[model samples]
Target: MKVACTEKSQILGSKVAKTLGLPLVYSQFKAFPDGELYLKTGALDGETLLVSSTADNQSLVQLLLMIDACDRSEITLVLPYMGYARQDKRFNDGEPISSRAVARALSAGVSRVITINIHEPSVLSHFRAPAIDITLAPEMARWVASLGCDEPIILAPDKGAVIFASEIAKHGGWEYDHLSKTRLSGEEVRIAPSSVDAKGRDIVITDDIISTGGTLATAAGMLKDGGARSVHAACVHGVFASGGFARLAAAGLASIAASDTIESAASSYTAAGMIAEAMRE
Candidate 1:
């Protein structure tokens, strides 16, 4: 079977296809000045995997169109980073759960789906197919340990991220703590460390997603202020929407690393092999 990728997702998808011994299928993508997207592929294949990360609006749109192109064959969708997942629930009465809109568009032509550490698995309910959700904390922990940095400490940006931090800590055989968050508003928050002294320690603030990055940046600042010698980040999906990357960098993160779950600059490494292994089963 041949494999292909949506415009933006080609980068990471190519890596996965290469690892799985599949040829990279190419398609043309461009838009008219009037806002219509044009898409085409050379020939039809029996089955095709359409890989794309919904990191932003353009990717989301391209994924929908590509699914239509695969009408002749079965389509398996791989979205390492799924956007709008955190908004699965409506915070207010009139607010729409954008995840449903995204899920509906995605499930339209796809036969199955796979994602890594989705913000919420309940969002899978939006898809009408066999879905698999996985994580990359195992690889991340191994990498962190190999780094052999000075006195290490694992910290979760907030209580919601504690589970991910815990996994990494378990993998590295280290200790961890969570930062409590009081969401003041959609864009404002207050954070407090639940335990542990980070002073002069190598603080690794970890999380699944980093959209806007307000939470991670704040925690990083606090860690430094509280006497932590350094701050680093290892996120599963670097969803740096709204220029959150610059903000996080400015917040004093020494080195930021992210798995290739999203098409971003920090995806120096990947866990696609693990993802494919799960799909193979």
Candidate 2:
């Protein structure tokens, strides 16, 4: 099978193709004056590996178009960063589950689906095809290991992400904890490492997605104020919506990085190796 990709995931798709020693199909993308998306991929007949990161509406539509373009090929879809996954639940009446909607749309004509650190694993149930999710904790562990920090602490922003943090910490036998909050008053709250003092310790706050920098940025300041030597941030998808990275930097975070799931200046690591390994098996 040959590898193909939407425009947004060209770099990552290329890496995965190279790792697996598969021929990468060339593609051309265009936009008309009326804002219609256009794409054409090299001839594909049998099996195909289609990689795409649907980070926004345009990318999502492009993915649908690319899938349709491979009508005769059996496609294995890879969504490295799936948008709208956090909206797995419908809170109000007359509201649709956005995650389910997107999943159903993409599942059409696909043989199987693979995702990386999807915000909610439960969302997989909405897909029409067999779906599997992968994590980048191993990659995160390796990246932090190269930082040469003294037994750095791996911290999840909240309890919800503790499992992911634990996975990363175990790789190096490092300490792991979740940020705990205490209410001093209606106007003031305190956040710090739970069950452990962060004093003079290097801390890495990690999560699956970093959409807005509000929480992490706020926690960074408090972690430093709590006497932590330094604070850093890492994640699987760095959506970094609206000055997220700048906010983290302004909060005094020593560094901020993410996987190439969504190519950006801060994508200091890669998910290609893991994707290739999974595909090989």
Candidate 3:
């Protein structure tokens, strides 16, 4: 089997292909004057590992096109970052479950699906094909270790992320805790470690996604104000929307990094190794 990718995931697709000791399928992409997408693949074998991060509408359409292009081949689809996954539920009466829509649409042509830290695992069941999700906690932990932090404590910005934080912290036997909010007064509020002392300790905030970085940025400043020596941020998907990275840096984050799942300036790590292993298994 050969490896192929949509336009947006070329860098990560290449890395996965190399790690798996497979050839990278040459693909050319362009946009027509009317704003339609175009793509041409060199060649595809009977089985293909197709890597694509649907980070936007165009990328999603492109992935469908690529799957059709590999019509004769069995495809193992990899979605490093699923764009519409956050809309997993329909809150209003007339609303559609967008995650289900996208999943069913994409599952039509692929034999199996793989996702990295997907926003909602339930969406996987929406796919007609067998689907699985993988974690980048080990990669994130390694990246945190490379930071040379002084006994840094891994922190989850909220309770929902405590499990992920613990996974990262266990790699280095670091203490882990979730941030807690307290109402100091009618107009005052405070955010700090739930049970651990942040004073004189380095901290790393970890999560699956960092969309606007608003919560993390605010937490970073608060942690610093609470006497934490340093605060950093890390995640599996760095969806730094609306100048999120800049916001985190400006909020006094000592450092910020994320996995290549979303391919941004802050992608200090890659999920290729994990992906390759999953494919082999």
Candidate 4:
């Protein structure tokens, strides 16, 4: 088996390659002055694992090109962060199931697919090939445990994230609970149970993604108001879109940490080992 990676995921791909004891294949990528992309990879054969994170349209396009380049090789597509996964269903009439569309596009020329901490696990059903969804929750939990907080509490910003919080708490051996959120409008939200007694206790908010960071900011503020000693945030994918990290910091979070799924400044953990293990299985 051999390992290859797209430009954006090179760091993580190298880590995974090391873990798998596989030779890493390098690909050349270039953008024309007209804004078109070009990719070049050596002759691909045998079992080849292509690692990429579809974090944006450019990355997705590049990945598609790379997959097409691997002629006749058994391709194992590894998407550390699958974009458009949140839109797994058509919410209204005339709406596209974006996740399914993306999955269809990605399934082309691939034998199997693997993703880490994808937003909707159900999205795997959209793929024609066998798809595997892995989680970085345990790795994130280990990072939290290394923080060495004397009195720590794991908090989920919303009920949907309670499972993530529970995973962290379980691994870290701490108490955990989720906050209730009432969205009044796009910019306005109400977070509760407003009565968490976090006084003098370190709080860690765990979630799958931190896209806009509005929910996390609101939750952090509420925790601060509730007298938490300090607030930290962790997630599997840190999209940090539109100044999201700054917003979370401004909301009084002491620190923000995330896995290397998206390759952001907040990426303090690596899920390469986890993905490598899944590939072995």
lDDT of 4 by residue, 113-175 (tens): 998988889999999899989989889888888888885888887778788788778886788
- For model 3, residues 165-207, the per-residue Cα lDDT tens digits are 9999999999999999999999988999999999999999999
Worst 10 residues of 4 by lDDT: 189-198
- What are the runs in model 2 whose C-alpha is more than 4 Å off? none
lDDT of 1 by residue, 169-216 (tens): 997778888877668899976564678777778888888877788778
Q: Of the pair 1 and 4, which is ahead by lDDT? A: 4
Candidate 1 residue-pair clash tally? 0
Query: In terms of lDDT, which candidate is stronger, 1 or 2?
Result: 2
Q: What lDDT is reached at residue 253 by model 4?
A: 89
lDDT (C-alpha) at residue 62 in model 1 = 83
C-alpha positional error of residue 109 in candidate 1 after TM-score superposition, expressed in Å: 2.2
Using lDDT as the measure, name the better of candidate 1 and candidate 3: 3
Q: What order do candidates take by lDDT, descending?
A: 2, 3, 4, 1
lDDT of 2 by residue, 65-124 (tens): 999999899999999999999899989999899999999999999999999999999999
TM-score of 3: 0.98
Model 3 worst lDDT run, 10 consecutive residues = 258-267
Give the range of the ten consecutive residues with the poorest summed lDDT in model 1.
188-197
